[model samples]
Target: MKLSLAEQMREMDKKAIEHGIPDIVLMENASIKSFYQILDAYGDVSGSLAVCFVGAGNNGGDALAIARHLYNNYCDVFIYMLVPEEKLNPSPKTNFEIIKNMGIPYKFVENDDDFDIEVINEADLIIDGIFGTGLSRKVEGRFKKAIELINDSDAFVVSVDIPSGIKADSGEVMGIAVEADLTPTFALAKPGHFLYPGRIYAKDVRVVDISTPVSVIEEFDPSFVAIDSSQIKLTYRNPTSHKGDFGHLAVVGGSTGKSGAVIMASKAALKSGVGLVSAVIPASINTAFESHLLEAMSYPVDDNGGFFSENSIDSILEFVADKSAVCLGMGLGVTESTKKVVKAVMGIEKPMIIDADGLNCLSFFVDELKNRKAPTIITPHPKEFSRLCGVKTKEVLEKRLELIKEFATNYNCIVVLKMADTLIASPDGKIYINTTGNVGLATGGSGDVLSGMIGAFLAEGYEPLQAAINGVYLHGLAADIATESSISYESLMPSDVIENINKAILSFFEA
Candidate 1:
C-alpha cells in the first residue's frame, strides 16, 4: 500500500476538499470509521466509560464527533478538551457545538493540575485525538502530561491518524507519545505508523477510508510503499522446468574462522530455489565449506595465510564469471588484499549484493559504486552504512530515509538499510519499508542469509527492486514462522531462519 508523509497527506486532504468533499463530511467519515474500529476492538461500548482527549484541530474534531456516536450508543462519554471551545479550529468548533448541544459532560483543562487522573484511570477506553500527523515539534505542557497519563492507565487506547507526539515523517518520538492499542488512520498509512518507535506505539493500524477521491491520490503519486505478501510478484514455475531453469548464484566470502557465514549463505541461496549455488572461499576455509555445504560447489582460492589475499582475485573472478548473480561479503575479513578483490569484482557486469565485511571494504572506495552500470545492492546496517556514507552511526539512524535515498540516487544503486524496520531505497527514489520479521532476526549471520535470498531472486530474473523487496519480506517472514513454531526469540539463529525459508515462501503463495 502507498505510504504518505504528513505533508503529502495534507495535500491530499486539500485536493480532496477542493474536489467537493467538505471538511465536516471528512471528519464525520473519519469518526464513524474509527468508531467501528473501536467496536471491533472493544466489543460492546454501550455502558462503557470512554474519555476523549480532544484538542483544537481536526483530529480533535474527529474525537468530538466520535463522542456523539458513543453517546448515541449509550456510552458514558466525557470529553477532556485540551483547549477552550473557542480555541477549536473551524470544523472542530462545529463538532464541539454539536457535542455541547447533546449535553455530553466535558471539562476544559489548561494544565496537568486540572486533569482528573483518578477518573482517567477508572475509564474503560481512552480516545487519543490531541495531535495528528501535522505534529512536528516536541509535545509539552498539558499535552505531554495527558499522554503520560494515558500511557500510565490500563485502559484500552485508540489513537486517531497517528499516536500523539510522533513525528509523522520520521517516527521520532517528541518528548513522549501515546501508547495506543489501536490506530485508525485515514486514506493512507503514514511513515510514523511503520517506522521504529512509532510502530511500537501504533500497535495495530487500521486504515480508514474518509472519501478522498482516487484521482486526488493518484495525482500525488506517493513513492513510499509498505511491502507485504500482496506486493510480492513471483513467477510460477513451469511444469516441465528443470533445475537449470531456476538460476545459478555465487556466494563469495569466507575466511578461516568465519566460514560458517558463507556456509549459511550458500545454503540459504539453495533453499531459496536457485538452480545451483557455489561458495567461493579462501583455500584455508575450503575444508569447512566442503564439510558443511553438501549441495553447493566450492571454489577454493589461494589465501595469504588464512585470509583472502590478492592472489585469490583472478581465481575468484573466473569462478563467478558464469554465475547469474553474486552475493558478496559475509565474514570476509577487511584487509588490503580483500579490498583489492572487492574493488575488482565491482567491475563485473552482473547484479551484486554487498553485505558484512564487503561493505567495510567498499567504505574505502564508495565512489567506485558510481562507476558501475550493473545493478548493485548494498545491504548495510547502521554502523556499516555510516562507514559507507562517512557519517556517525547516530546520524544514520536519525536521517536514514534521506541519507539512503540520496546515496542510492547518487550511486545509481539499490540500498537496503537494515534495522528493526528495514528500508529499501531504489535509484529512482522509490522507498519500500519492510513490515515483516521480528526481534529474533537480531542474531548474527542473519544478513548473510538475507543477501543470499536476494541473490537467488536476482538470478531468477526478478527486477532488482522486487528481488530486494521479496528477499527482505521472506527473510523476516521466515524468522517469524520460526518463532511462532516454538522457537524462542533469544535462541533463533540464522540457520533456523534459513530452514524456514521454504515455509515462508509457501505461506506467501497460500496468502
Candidate 2:
C-alpha cells in the first residue's frame, strides 16, 4: 500500500466525501473498526473501564462514537472532553449530545486543574483522541497533561487515527507524544507511523479500512511508497546464457588498513550474481586481496601514503574498460591524491556506486556532479549525507526528505540515504522507502556490502534507481534472514548477510 503524508490523506478523505460517502458514515465505520480491534486486543469488555480523551475535532467525534459502542457493550466508559460541549465541531457535538442523552458520564477539562489524575489511573484501557493527523502546533495546556496522565497509567492505550503530538507529514514529535501500544489508523497509514521517534511511539500499527473507495486512493497517486516483496522483479535468464553474458563488475578503493572494505564489497558483488568481479587496491597490498579473494581478479593501483594516488587514475580507467559497472570509495581515505583519483573516477560515464570515503571525496567536488554525464549513485549514511550537503547532522535528520529530493533534482543523480528507514530518491522525483531490514544491519561493513550489491545490479542491466532499491531491499532482507536464523539482531555480521544473499533472492522470488 502507498504510504502517505497528512495532506495527501486529507485530500483522499475529501474526495471520498465528494463522491457520496458521508462524513458521519466514515466516523461510524471508524468507530466500529476501533471497537472490534479493542475487543480483539482485550477480549471481553463486560465491566472494564474505558476512559476516552476526546478533543474538539472529528477525532474527538470518533472517540465519542467509540465510547457509545463500549457503553452499549456493558463496559464502564468515561469521556474526558478537552473542550466545552458547545464549542465542538458539528459532528462531534452531535455525538456528544447523543452520548449525554444515553446517560454516559463525561467531564469537560480545559486545563490541568480541572482534570482528575486518580480517575485516569483507574481505567483498564485508554483511548487517545486528543489529536490526529492534522495536528501542527506543539501540544500544551490541558491536552499535554492529559497525554501525560494517559501515558503514566497502566492501561493499554489504543490511539485513534494517529498518536497525538506526532506530525503526520514528517513523523516528528510536536513537543511530546503518547506512546501507544496499538494504533488503528483510519483508511491508510501515515509516514509518522513508520518514521523514527514517531515509529518508536507508535508501537504496533494496524491500518483500518473506513469505507474509502480504493478508486479515490488510486486517483490521488501518492509518490511515496514502502516497498514490499511483490514489487521485486528478477527477470528470467536465458538458459543458454554463459558467465560472460551476465556482465563483469569492478570494485575500487581500499587503503592501507582498510583493504577489507573492498574485499567485502567484491565478495558481495560476486555473491549478488555478477559474472566476474575484480578488486582494485594499492599495489603494496595487492597480494593480500589476491590471497583472500580467490574468485575475484585483483589489480594493483599506484598509492601514496597507503592511499590511491592521482597517477593511479590512468590504470584504474584502464581496468574499468572491460567492466560494466564499478563500486568505488569503500575505504579510500580523504587525502589529496585520493581526491584527484576520485575526480578522475567520477569523470567516467560508467554507472558507478560511490560510497563511504567516496562520498566524503564527492562532498569536496559536489559542484562537479552538475557536469557529470554518467548516472552516479552515492550511498551515504546520515553523517555522510550531512557532510555532502554541508549542513548540520540535526538539519539533515530533521529535513531528510526535502534535502534528499533537492539534492537528487539538482545533481541529477540517484541517492541512497541510508538510515534506520532507508530512502531511495530518484532524479525524476520518485521516492521509495525500504520496508525490509532489522537492527542486525547496523554492523560495520553492511553499507559496503550494499554498495557492491547495487553495483552488481547495475552491471546486470537494471536501471540505476531500480538497482539501488533492489540492492538495499535484498541487503536488509539478508540481515533479517540472518537474525531469524540466530534469533538475534546483535550476532549477525556483514559476512552473515552475504552468506544469506542466495536465500534472500530465493525468498524474493517466492514472495
Candidate 3:
C-alpha cells in the first residue's frame, strides 16, 4: 500500500468530510475499530481500567469519542485532557460534551502534577491521543511529561492516528513519543509508522478504514509505496527457453581476505535466475572462488598486491563485453588503485549495481556516475550514504528521503538506501520502502547478496528501477523466510539468506 504524508492524510480526511461523511462518523469508525482491536488483544475490556491521554486537537476528539465507547462497553475509562474543555477544538469539544453528559470520569491535566503516576499504575491500557500527524516541533512541558509516564508504565498502549510526538513524515521522535503496543491508524498508514524510532514507538500498526473513499486517496497519486511481493514483476520462464536466454551477469570485487563477498554475490546471482553468472575477481582468489562457487563461472583479473588495480579495468571490461549486467564493490578494498578500476567501470555503459567498497570509492567520484553510458544502481547503508553526501550520519537519516531523491535524480541513477526500512529511490522521483526482512539481515555480506540479486534482475531484463525494487524486496523476503524456521536473527547469515532465495522467489509467485 502507498503510505501517505501527514498533509496528504489530512487532505484525505477533509475530502471524506466534503463527500458527506461526517467528521464525527469518521471518528466513530476509528474509535470503534480501535475498540475491537483492544478486545482482540485483551480478550475483554469489561471493568478493565483504560487511561486515555487527550490533547486539544482533532486527535483529542478521537480520544473523547473513544472514551464514550469504552464506557459504553463497561470498561472503566479515565479521560485526562491535556487542555481545558473550553480550549478543545470544535470536534473535540463536541465529543467532550457528549462524554461529559455520559458522566465519564475525567480530569484536566494541564500541569506536571496532574500527570498522575497512580492513574497510570492502575490502568490495563493507555490511549495516546496527545498529538497527531501534523506535529512539527519537539514535544515539551506537560505533554513530554505525560509521554514519559506512558513509556514508563507497564500497560498496553494504543495510539490513535499516530503515536503522540512522532513526526509523521520522517518517523523522527519529537523529544518524546508514546511507545504504543498497537496503533490503529485512520485511513492510510503514514511514513512515521514504518520509519525507525517511530517504528519502534508504534510496535504493531493496524490501518483502519475510517470511511475515506478510494477516489479521495487516488487523487493525490502518491508515489511512495511500501514494498510488497505483489509489486515484484517475476518473469516466468518458457519451456523452450535456453540457459543463455536470461542474460549473463558479471560480479566484480573480492580482495585478498574478502573473496567471500564476490563468492556470495555470484552464488546469489545464479540463485536469482540469472542465466549465466561469473565472478571477476583478483586472480589470487581464483582458487577460493573456484572452490566455493560451483554453478558460477570465474574470470581472473590481474591483481596488484592481492587487490584489483588500475590494470584490472581492461580485463573487467573485456570480460563484461557481452554481459548484460555488472555488480561491483563487494569486499574490494578502498585502495586508490581499486578506486581507479571502479571509476573506469562506471563508464562501461552496462547496468551496474555498486555496493560496499564500490559505494565507498564512488563517494569520492560521485559526479562520474552522471557520465556513465548506462544506468547505475547504488546500494548504500546509512553510513555509506552519509559519506557520499558529506553529511553526518544523523543528518543523513533525518533527511534520508530528501537526500536519496536528490542523489538519484541528480545522478540519474537508482539508489537503494539500506536502513531499517530499506528505501529504493528512482531517478523519476518514486520511492519504495521495503517492509520485509528482520534484524537477522544485520550481519555482514548481506549487501553483497542484495547487489548481486539486483544485478541478476537487471541481467534478466527488468528495468533498472524495477531491478532495484525487486532485488531489495526479495533480499529481505529471503531473510524473513530464513528466520521463520528457528534460525534466530543472531545465527542467520548471508549464506542462509542465499539458501532461501528460491523459497523467497517461489513465495513471491505464490503470493
Candidate 4:
C-alpha cells in the first residue's frame, strides 16, 4: 500500500502504543535514524560545528537527541533551540535537558534578527529539525527568519523528518519550508518528496524506517500505488501462442503525411502482443501503410490525405465492428468533418482508446463523452487536459490529482495524465503513479504507441482496468528496456520502442 505521511504516522503511533513503545522511545528511534543518516551523508568529522534548528515538538526533540549524538561523536554540535525551554514539548523537554546536561552550548532565541545572524554565521552544517508533521500553519515571525538563514547558509543542511513548513498530507507549502540539501524522511516517502515546490526544496530524498511495524501498514489501504520496475513484470508471449491466438487490434487514424503516427501506434500494438493489427487510414494512404507494415493490415476509409471526413464515419464503424478492440485519434488532425466522424464512432459504443486528436475533439463537445455507453480509456497530456477543462495548463499541473480524479469521474472514463511520473486515475478515485519508465518515454509519438498497445490488450478481452494498468506498464517498460540498451529518451522514436515491448512483457512474466 502507498502510505502518505499522515497515514503512516497514524499507523506507526497506533502500533507503537499498542506494543507498549512510549512516544519518547519513538522519538529516540527517529533521532537515531536522523543521526545515522547525517553521519552517512557527511562522515569522519574531525572538527566541525553542526547548528540544529529546534522547534517546540518532536522534531525539535529529534534535534536535541542528534545534538547528543554529535557531542558523543566529537563534533562541535550546538542547538539553536528556538522554542523556549519553559515552553518545551514534553519529549523535547527531556532531550533538551539531556543535551544541556551533556555540556553542549545551546542558544535560545526570542528575537528574529538575533537568531538569524547567529545561526547562519556560526553554522557549519544546519540540521532542520523544526516543525515536522505537526505543523498546520506557515513558518512566520521568528521561525521564518531562521528558515531564511538556513536557506542562505553555505552549510550542508539536513532535514530531520521532512522539510519544515511543507504539508505532509498535501505537497502545499505552509508559508515557508527549510530548503534542505538532503531530506531523510521517516517510513514511506511523503507526497512532498516528489511533488512541486516541496520537491524543489528537497534536493535529495532518502526513506528511513523508525522501527514501525509492517503489520500496522497492512491495515492501511492506500489508494495510490507507485508502479515501479521492482513491481510487476510484463514478459513476451510463449512459444505456443502464434499469430491467431494472441489478439487483433484495429487503429483508426492517420491522414496522408501524418501516416507515421498511425504506423508507429500500430507497430507498438503488434509488438506488445496483438496477433494482428490494422490501421484504417484514408483510402489514398492504404497502400502506403500496408506496404510499410507487413505484420499489420491497412483498411482504407474516405478522404484523400488531411483528415477523416464526416462521410467516412459510416464505413469506419462498419469496418471495425467485428475487430477485437479499437484505437483512435493519432495524427488525425482536428477538423469539423473529423469531429463528426469521431462522434459517430464514439456512438458505436465499442471498447476503445482515445488519445491525441481524439482528445482534442472531445474538448469541443465534452457532452458526447457523457454517455460512452461503453468502457473507454482517455490519455491526455497537460496541454490536452487544459483544453478539456478550459483552464490554463499551469492550473492543471498544480492540482494534478484533483483535476484527474474529477475528469475521470465526470467522463466515466479512465484518465492517464502523462508527466515525469505518469498518473493513472480511474473513475472510482483509484490513482496509480507509474514509476516504471524514465524520462526516455517523453518523446512525441510515445503517447500514440501507448494508446495502441493498451487497445491491443482491450481487444484481447482483458478487464478495462487491467488492460490500462498493463498497457501503461508495458509502454513504460519498453522505454526502460530500450534505455538500458543505450537508446535514451532524448533519442528514442516511436518506431524504435516497438521492438522493446516483447522484452518488457517477458520481463514481467518472469518476475
- The regions of model 1 sitting more than 4 angstroms off are none
Model 2, 150-173: lDDT tens digits are 889999898988899998877789
lDDT of 1 by residue, 1-511 (tens): 8999988988888888998999999999999999999999889999899999998789999999989999999999988999987889999999999988999999999988989988999999999999998887899999999999999999999998899999888888998999999999999999889999888999889999999998877767777888977888888889999988988998889998999999998999899889999888899999889988799999888998777889878888988888899999998999999999899988888889999999999999999999886899999999999999999999998889999999999999999999999999999898899999999999898998999999999888888999999999999999999999889999999999999999999975676
Worst 10 residues of 3 by lDDT: 221-230
Candidate 3, residue 498: how far the Cα is off, in Å: 1.2
Highest-TM-score candidate = 1
Q: Give each model a TM-score.
A: 0.99, 0.94, 0.95, 0.85
What lDDT score goes with residue 398 in model 4? 84
Q: Model 2 segments beyond 4 Å from truth?
A: 236-238
Worst 10 residues of 2 by lDDT: 222-231
Error of 2 at 326 (Å): 1.4
The residue pairs found clashing in candidate 1 are none
Query: Where in model 3 is the C-alpha error above 4 Å?
Result: none
Question: Candidate 1, after superposition: displacement of residue 499 in Å?
Answer: 0.9
Better candidate by lDDT, 1 or 2: 1
> Global CA lDDT of candidate 2, please?
0.87
Pairs that collide, model 4: 233-508, 234-505, 234-506, 234-508, 235-505, 235-506, 236-505, 236-506, 440-489
Clash number for every model? 0, 0, 0, 9
- Put down candidate 4 lDDT per residue, 388-486, tens digits, no spaces: 989999999888888998988988999889887678888888777765677777777889889888888887767787778888877877888888897
lDDT of 1: 0.92
